[model samples]
Target: MRLFLVIFAVIIISGCDDSNSKPSTKLSEQQSSSLLTIKDESVIPETEFSIVFTPNNEVEIIDAYIEGVDMYMGRIPLFFSRTNKQLQYIASGMVGVCSKNEMVWRIYLHYRKNGTQEGKIATLNFVVTNT
Candidate 1:
């Protein structure tokens, strides 16, 4: 009888846990996309820059592609920062070679919430210049 009571108490306490409860405030679980751009006059090679992308809803980056001169020939490392809410990319040395040219980066983002299937492509444009 004591064992049965202890088991019942454990189950009751576990049931009171609210770890699976929904948040008090509702968060919109929609899919959306927006363009991220840099207004700098020049993007120096071998430098790292933070690219910010704001979506209408929370989303995670899927993949990225960059185009401009030979910028795509080499590996352009990308780091995702959730705290700062930005994506950091290292400019390849080819950027300076592509000076006076336009560099475009496309990022694929996906929103996975509320059983909704939504995706967005964020485009970023920058001008490679030597200052």
Candidate 2:
């Protein structure tokens, strides 16, 4: 009975560990499929994050906004500047806060030369790391 209990506890602990450490972003074919890479793999709510854009064509970030998918977090504008050559887009401050453990946030990246009206929409449904 002791051995069985220990094994059960071990299994429960291991199962609680987060498996989705690396967040994945999905974009349609028209949106270039995979051009946006969130700097840090793990993202937290109401935190600043930089998005690195790697496009084949000449790109210019006009604007970027993030919205909560599962809930209504409102459309918040992310920070971005043409001069900031390093982080094309940056999001911070009152961005997202959810009641659940995981909240799906989507970023609508509006950039020039992305071959779409206004900008390409990318749904970044990622798991928010610990508080």
Candidate 3:
């Protein structure tokens, strides 16, 4: 009886440990999938993001105006391009909508070529990562 009880206890502890770790694994996976990586400020359809500057030529984002609570543009910029331009912002302060490791955000991209303005506001779902 004593041996049986000890085995049962060990099994219970192991089961609990496994259960607790499952959520963490799932969360990490979700986070990884949602992370957004901006390469050279280019927005592509799947992997990279790019801004459509002209019908034939597309340039990377160089600036952005994030919408605020009252639909106002944020004063400070959150993201930038290598050109040292304001290219993105965390509109809602990175909470709620961006609380989860994988979240969605409403963002704006500002890019231009020559004297033509060609960026627009858009919504993107990205996984927030430290890297």
Candidate 4:
């Protein structure tokens, strides 16, 4: 009889504690704006530039290139079957060059499941000066 009473008391206390817990609220716009914001007003150097692609699913990154530069092309096989969420890929070899001019780049992603084309092209302008 004592063990049964103790068990019942424990369950009742646990239920009461959970009922008294406050629900979580979403963050306000002002609070969240700066959390994930990117400030692009300031000019960044060309050598500091890179290309990024957010994939919608498990994808094999076929190639990333600076559009007109054939030598800049490269491939990467990515597996995201565990999660169909967004995944990011960054372009390589163009890290730090002082070339403050506009350039176009393309990132091509191949879905592993259906073999469909998921490509993205981005144009960025930044100043690059010889260091």
Candidate 5:
């Protein structure tokens, strides 16, 4: 009777552990679909450029870079709320003007969550006219 009771207790504890374990399979599926999509028109020189982030949610934006240059690395306020739903112009501070006549600037959007990279990086290319 003592042997049977010990075996039953071990089985019960193991079952509890299994229930507490995180579901890796489900988490992977969600992570694979997590992506950032920038839906804004191209930026023109001498004119203010407004970038809009769609489907704004709880995604933590690590940084926003333009043409390999850090625009809002740590100085500017980077937090975005869902109520706004748009990152307006002049909000991200000033960006350097393009010197070339026809320059193709690439905007990189980096995102993360809980200090871990959520595998979300979006790139948008825009031309900067000399005008």
Candidate 6:
């Protein structure tokens, strides 16, 4: 009977252990930055640059694409990486080419927050210094 009692007590103790319980996801979740950064803001076409993306929140997946906003360049897919909370990429500069002195490119970002099926989109624009 004593052994049975001890077993029951152990079960009860384990059941009431809050220390092992996972914290609320909503509590730890906060909005992150959508637009990351480019090492050089004065971007030059066909030149590579270091870019980073910080999603608005933890995400399961993120996909990005770039296209010319001021000229004719079809949407081109881009690949990047997520380390901790930041996504890094070495962009192969702008594909936009036109008669204008400055070329404009728009990046469309799509992401799915961690533990969710709902998706989000962010739009960022940059100019190429046709120098």
- Candidate 2 minimal-lDDT segment of 10 residues: 12-21
Q: Which ten residues in a row have the lowest lDDT in candidate 5?
A: 16-25
List the lowest-lDDT window of 10 residues for candidate 4: 16-25
* Candidate that beats the other on TM-score, 3 or 5, i.e. the better one: 5
TM-score of each: 0.45, 0.60, 0.26, 0.30, 0.44, 0.60
Off by over 4 Å in 4: 1-46, 68-86, 92-131
Worst 10 residues of 6 by lDDT: 19-28
Question: Clashes in model 3: which pairs?
Answer: 34-126, 34-127, 35-127, 42-49, 43-49, 43-50, 44-48, 44-49, 44-50, 63-86
lDDT of 1 at 20: 14
1-131 in candidate 2: lDDT tens per residue? 67545633433342222322245666645675436667775664435566655555656677676666766645666665442554344444233445555556666676666565556554454555434
lDDT of 5 by residue, 1-131 (tens): 67545633443342211111111111122344443323324443323434444423455666765541222121112233343434322123122343234444455556655455554655544444444
For candidate 6, lDDT tens digit of each residue in 49-82? 5555665566654777766676645565666666
Per-residue error at 117 for model 3, in Å?
3.3
Q: Write the per-residue lDDT of candidate 3 for residues 22-72, one digit (tens) a residue.
A: 001111232232212333332211122332111123345466532323222
Candidate 6: residue 100 lDDT (0-100): 56
Off by over 4 Å in 3: 1-62, 65-76, 83-103, 121-123, 127-131
TM-score of 1: 0.45
Candidate 1 residue-wise lDDT, 1-131, digit = tens: 67545633443442211111111111123322343434233444434444444454555665543444324433233444454544322222212133223333332233332245655445443444223
lDDT of 4 by residue, 1-131 (tens): 67545633443342211111111122223332111111232223222223344434445644332322222222222222222334544543232221223322222332232365644322222222222
lDDT of 4 at 103: 24
lDDT of 3 at 78: 38
Off by over 4 Å in 5: 1-47, 55-57, 68-82, 85-94, 113-117
- Relative to the unseen true structure, what is the C-alpha lDDT of residue 104 in candidate 6, on a scale of 0 to 100? 61
lDDT of 5 at 21: 10
Deviation from truth (RMSD, Å), model 1: 21.9
lDDT of candidate 3 at residue 54, scale 0 to 100: 19
Tell me the alpha-carbon RMSD of every candidate. Answer: 21.9, 13.2, 18.6, 23.6, 23.5, 24.1
The Cα local distance difference test for each model comes to 0.36, 0.54, 0.29, 0.29, 0.38, 0.51
Clashing pairs in 6: 32-56
